[model samples]
Target: MVIGPDGCGFDMRSPSEMEADDARREADEAAHAPRMAVTSRIRRVAQPPDGYLPLSLFDEVRLADPVPLYAFEDVPADVTGLAVDYLSRVARGVPARDAFRVPLAGARLVGRSADAERLLAMVDGFSDRSVRAACLLCGFDAASRRGPARWRAGRVIDPGPATVYNVRRMVARTLRFMDRVGPVVWEGFTFDGGYTDRVTSGDGDLLTADGLWDLKVSRWPPNPTYTLQLLVYWRLGLHSTHPEYLRVRRLGLYNARSDTMWSVPAARIGADAVRAVERDVIGYADGL
Candidate 1:
């Protein structure tokens, strides 16, 4: 299900059709709407009297859509903490570290988001094996097979999709998933229209600055790459699909099992990290 050539869905045909369709769509979109980047910077009009939206109103938008493609893993607060610890170790370059003996209990959320209840619910349903699964989904063979328990030396990890892999293809799915996060619902902030989901722009849940939060459940070593993934989703509002929708002032990672969490400004995490990952992924596709 590749979107049109330019990463917009109006052109729903296959890759071959993308080039010409993209041209036409770009022209039409150009005349009708501004570039996503520019449009996003313009900011959406503040809604409601106080420049804020209520929790229940946001629920209606959540209900409008039949399915949410972006994954919201329901993992325990404790397990998330463990992931954080494990990440710290990996980042420190303790190649031989093992995660099996580490217990998952102390993971605490450092910040909160608008979808707090739903996010917590999702984490409740999440499994510790998710990272491994992501590797598999990317079409690679991985062996270290890390879990909530231990790490291994000489573990053959999958680098993920090769060059020649379709950039437009792989990223579109990821981008669309990134696009659906609701507007910032924390009462103090407001949004512009650049954001939208399958239903409508500004339709989903809004996390007031207080509402935006993330939980990490770990099994393997820490990865700067992993942290950056979180930053990218937060900082750019997953590509700045809408204005002020994800104005994240406070973001953090919780280590559930250990009752530990680290909160930081989105900028402190370094914006280029995710872009670097994106670049590598694209390079993989090119090699393919």
Candidate 2:
């Protein structure tokens, strides 16, 4: 019924609007007029956790990791998510309402991988435009009118295999360059509303050696807006589990096509940035 922020993807059925739309469709089908369809822009509202601050340059765009300082202050777990939940249903090969009954084996489920896989699994739940939305959300593809949506088992799913391969290759190269990368702890994960599915911790999500590592995926590239995202997860572990923030304090960003992993310093990240994110978490808790 209701589409994304943009109000397209549905047949306009108001008597006047439908008449116009149908006439346009018929004209196109009959080669009487150039094919025409209505498209409307969706207005975006700026909203984030109090402590986290806005991720965009100002208000023109959104951030990558809105979660870094998002305290979930007033956000209901169900604040807004149905497409994502549907994808999880398809990916796990189970109904969304049903509990995940399958057992885990050697799967390193969590973080980016889980998001990507869930997108892979859920095909039917999305409309044509929604697929594009997911790709943009994951940084795999930009929202373009052209290009066929890569369907996964008949769903409009395409996780840009080319980009995924690129990420894999870069990580391997980084490991070779450093020569002492830590064993990735696949700490068993569950989808826990990071995007509709809640991925539980302790199960191995992907981690770099010593908790700091480089992520080189064919993505839109992480920016300051999204960096706090990694920071939040990092803080989760830092504040709760590790606390010492030891042995790991770096992140490298590699373009999906590029070879070099640009190392990031966990310690070197500015205090203001850290404070901004901390404020997000605290603000949520404090209900600010």
Candidate 3:
């Protein structure tokens, strides 16, 4: 039973309708609210990393785009990224099956969760086979809300062989890197709206023993947008009630596709730059 969006009660709108809706939403929020995600404020703030940091971390930029370790025939980067992230959590200490409960619950709510569970049961451990299953599961989870309505119906999802092939390879590279890192002090942690109510919620990937880290499973290099997002996450951590972030002294990015890492010391990010983001980008009130 392939469920269409209609079957799942998801609102189906044409591109124009969606665009108009977005325009209206933006217009309504324009006066009182700022952009919510850290990504939104990056270019708008116009605060380049060079404006804030003394040294460039990605100085030895790979001129050549990295050759993929495995062929991703049909899998999107989003599903692959989630699979790698989930596998990383499993590599640390999270139970493999349990980690997917929330996403799976969405399927369960619509009586489709059993199919995913049965499919996942074929793999017993964190093998390449398991990676493939995780990828499919992530795909199904992504599709549940975002995909066409028919996809949401009681359908058995096949994340495709390419997802298993590519994500397995990516996870192998990522695990090797993750093993060398310190213990995870934080995982998928979100922040309080300390600076602005308009920007309500955001989360960081990992705060390991060494520093704060963001995982990038994409083909792109670390641009200014990526750099600013990390900076925002770190600053948000400091502003939040969590005192543990005070001990974090570095920001890092791990590119799973290229098996590479880039980082900058938190100390290099000047206080004035951070203050500017708070005041300008994130809309912090004076003396707050």
Q: Top TM-score: which candidate number?
A: 3
**Model 3 regions more than 4 Å off:** 1-35, 39-68, 105-124, 127-129, 140-157, 192-195, 286-288
Where model 2 places Cα greater than 4 Å from the true spot, the runs are 1-153, 156-211, 242-245, 254-256, 281-288
lDDT of each residue in 92-139, candidate 2, tens digit only:
344532312111111112123455446444433344433333332333
Candidate 3 lDDT tens digits, 1-288: 245766765456788998999999876776666445564455566655464433375333232235566544466676678778877777666776766654475566556678679756754556656766776676565444333342444333456666566766776777666666667777776676454554555566788875888888888877767777787787777778887787887888888887778877776666777787666666666412
In candidate 1, what are the lDDT values of residues 1-288, reduced to their tens digit? 657778875635778787878789866764665222211221332223321211211111111222222222233323223333333333223331122112111011212122222222222111323332222122111111222133222232422332112221222222232234333243111223223221012111123343343333343322443343333334335444454444556454432222233445444433344343333321111211
lDDT, candidates in the order shown:
0.31, 0.34, 0.66
lDDT at position 258, candidate 1: 24
Clashing pairs in 3: 3-149, 3-150, 3-153, 4-149, 4-150, 5-149
Q: Compared to the true structure, candidate 3 yields what TM-score? A: 0.69
**Models ranked on lDDT:** 3, 2, 1
Instruction: Evaluate residue 272 in candidate 3 and report its C-alpha lDDT on the 0 to 100 scale.
Output: 77
